[model samples]
Target: MKIRLWLIMAIMLAAIVLAATGCGATTGPSTIVTSQQNTGVWVSGQGKVTAVPDVAILTLGVQVQESSVAQAQSEAAAAMNAVTKALGDKGVAGKDIQTQRFTIYPIMRWDESKLQEVLVGYRVENSITAKIRKVDDTGSVIDAVVTAGGNFTVINGLSFTIDDPTDLLGQARELAMKDARNKASQLASEGGVKLGAPLYINESGGFIPIIQVPIARPGIGTPPS
Candidate 1:
């Protein structure tokens, strides 16, 4: 009877030890699964597409100098009026004409004889931006401004851009996605693991307008940023 009781106790202790060992084995696999779920590959890609621009934006202005502020302002207004009329005559819409800046400031010059700075004159500047729909007529519009404002007229900047870039953007996005997938695949292969399905995707870039303005002449203007 005592032998039987001892055998039963030994069996129960072995079963308890086996249960503890089994629990520890299960925990290791659970930790590994949690780590895998929290980790993933990250990468970025870039794409570019070139297409002919269909629109032009022009920044032109009038600057006048005079002995008094009132005189300078008057001269600037007259020049700007003529410039607007010229633009209207060339088919530019009123809504397309935007006033970018208008200012009147005094100019100072160093009087070497007096050894001090002195007020010389006042200067007035008025800047206007015009969006030209007919790209081919850009040269003629520039000529019109020059004829109206003469030496006071300054072409500050010009830029060309694609009015509708939907197709180009789609193509660029596809290329970027492919680039990312390729990089991820290469990394997975080198690491001796099969690439899993992508758990997340994000777009990092969008269309950037072209700024190169094909000027008909050297004095047209520089491109804006």
Candidate 2:
């Protein structure tokens, strides 16, 4: 799927300096310096890049409930092991499979006769975050994991993103600079001034991932491990 890389930069403006000997006024931030003495108009600009996602991230796990903690843990462990193996068989590297959570908690039920809650059994959950570098194989990988985990499979969520955003960020930054300069030029022209050079530029940027949320997310009362 298509993903976006958005970038914005702050091109601060300062007062223009008067030229000597009938020379032109100094340029600032690739546009004519604002001569408004702290009353200059503030311009905002953004540069965006659209690209295909190179990676797929999956949050998946296995959960089991049994009358005893050991039984729950054993079943959950076997299912999770199979899930990890399935990920590997689907070309996911070992380094990409990371255990995110493992919890065992009492499954409680209300005892109407005693007017108190009693532990009927225990629930064990084991989850992992796996990264699939081959984005095209995401669907097959998910299928394999689900099949391996069987009835206890829990697909928390999935997301698509760039593995390394350094290059994309650099490209976006260049575009943002160009966009800012263009806007600055427009402002200068409207204010009846010639375009000059840039004076101050401060760049800030962030990345947003494209996520495919599940229709239902499991409640998170499981104890952390």
Give the TM-scores of the predictions, in the order they appear: 0.70, 0.77
The regions of model 1 sitting more than 4 angstroms off are: 1-39, 186-194, 212-225
Number of backbone collisions per candidate? 0, 10
Candidate 1 local lDDT, residue 195? 55
Tens digits of per-residue lDDT, candidate 1, 77-147, equal 88889999999999999998999998888778888999999887888889999888787788888899888
Model 2 per-residue lDDT at 105: 86
Model 1 clashing-pair count:
0
lDDT of each: 0.66, 0.69
Worst 10-residue lDDT window, candidate 2: 13-22
